[model samples]
Target: MGERYLKSVRLLAECLQGFERFVAEPVRRHGLTHPQFDIIATLGNTPGMTYKELGERTLITKGTLTGVIDRLEQKGLVERARNCDDKRSFLVRLTAEGDTLFRNVFPAVVAHGKQLFADYGDGDFEQLDHALRRLRTRLDTPGLVTPGGHVPADEG
Candidate 1:
């Protein structure tokens, strides 16, 4: 049973499906992709971050982030300016419109996110978070490499 559960790709796929469906309507209503919203939200917290830093924080690759930035720029949602401190890098900042939109939509987005886990009480959520954090730390440690924590593996 344990082996069957571990090998079941359906479980992971369904989890991803649930997450995608949960956010699909709201993201579409806001005229944003999930990644776009994630970038904007990260920028809202850390203003004037370079594209590299933004990519790191958003977990978006450079190539993908460039496209997102281009779209946001065309939409007048984000502005890319020369980084005064680092001439080699471009600083990404939210425009006034972007700021206003984020401010308006963030609360609703947060509420909707909360609704995703509404079935879990605070205690359960806390415990889940703690366990996940531990798992992350273990998997992410630089020096302690294990097969499971190494390069992506195909369980299929």
Candidate 2:
């Protein structure tokens, strides 16, 4: 069990680090941090989303989201409007400049990232994808003891 844990943890970390290295240059060239790019990418195609939805989609925590959005707002890239249905929350969306940036950067970054995997056959991708989903399911099972040495309150 310990060996399985170490291998899986190291494998996931290595994959993430490789991808970050692959895409980091392009993201920096666009004058954005990795988290900023993540928020922009998540908000790209939609009209808008609430902070909660944005956080979920971007995998960014609330505290980080607010600061990132603040910087983006200062750059005149993104704007937030009062969520009419939920007066306490805001609907965040890209401004015209942001939309332009997204149109350019999204495809550029994706192309660059794809180049790293260009040699992989379709079946290779499929196998990895299947394995990742299986691992995610196992990790999300309730009552499972996590690396923290306590049962997670919920799958989340």
Candidate 3:
């Protein structure tokens, strides 16, 4: 059982690495890193999330989030405004340019994700999606125990 578990872990790691590489190619062509894209996508949906919220939503560290936000702000893809409730914190929102870029690129992103799992039939996709959702819910549940006895925020 231990050997089997180890093999499964190794396989999952390889799969994740491969998926990252595959997605990285297109994101690079769009002139954005994975973290940059994540921030933009989040801002697109949420509109006004503070840096701390972005870090939580993207599962990025505070240090890394600052760099990502700085780069995007430099590119005019996002803006930092003072949060009304907390003057000390800045809320992030996508610029008009950022919205345009997202609109143009998101369709391709969706297609690329679909193509990645295209080998799986509809039934397989449904089953995999269901299993992944269950796993995600369990992992996200507060105080829920993992094999390591701690449920991490970035379970990925």
Candidate number achieving the greatest lDDT relative to the actual structure: 2
Arranged by lDDT, best first: 2, 3, 1
lDDT of 1: 0.82
Write down the lDDT of every candidate, Cα atoms only: 0.82, 0.91, 0.82
For candidate 2, lDDT tens digit of each residue in 1-156? Answer: 667678878989998998998899999998999889988998899998999999998888999889999999999989999988879999999999999999999999999999889889989999999989998898767787878777777446
* TM-scores of all candidate predictions against the true structure: 0.79, 0.89, 0.79
Residue range 1-156, candidate 1, lDDT tens digits: 667645545765787698878766776798998888887788885567998999898889999999999999899989999988879999999999988878877777778777778799989979877966886797777555447865444333
lDDT of 3 by residue, 1-156 (tens): 667657756877898898878777767888999889888777775667888888888999998888888999899999989888888999889999998878766666767877878689989979878966886797667865668766665477
**Clashes per candidate (backbone, < 3 Å):** 0, 0, 0
Model 1 lDDT-worst window of ten = 147-156
Return the clash pairs for model 1, or none.
none
Which residue runs does candidate 3 get wrong by more than 4 Å? Answer: 137-156
For model 1, the superposed segments whose C-alpha errors exceed 4 Å read 1-13, 143-156
Worst 10 residues of 3 by lDDT: 145-154
lDDT of candidate 1 at residue 123, scale 0 to 100? 97
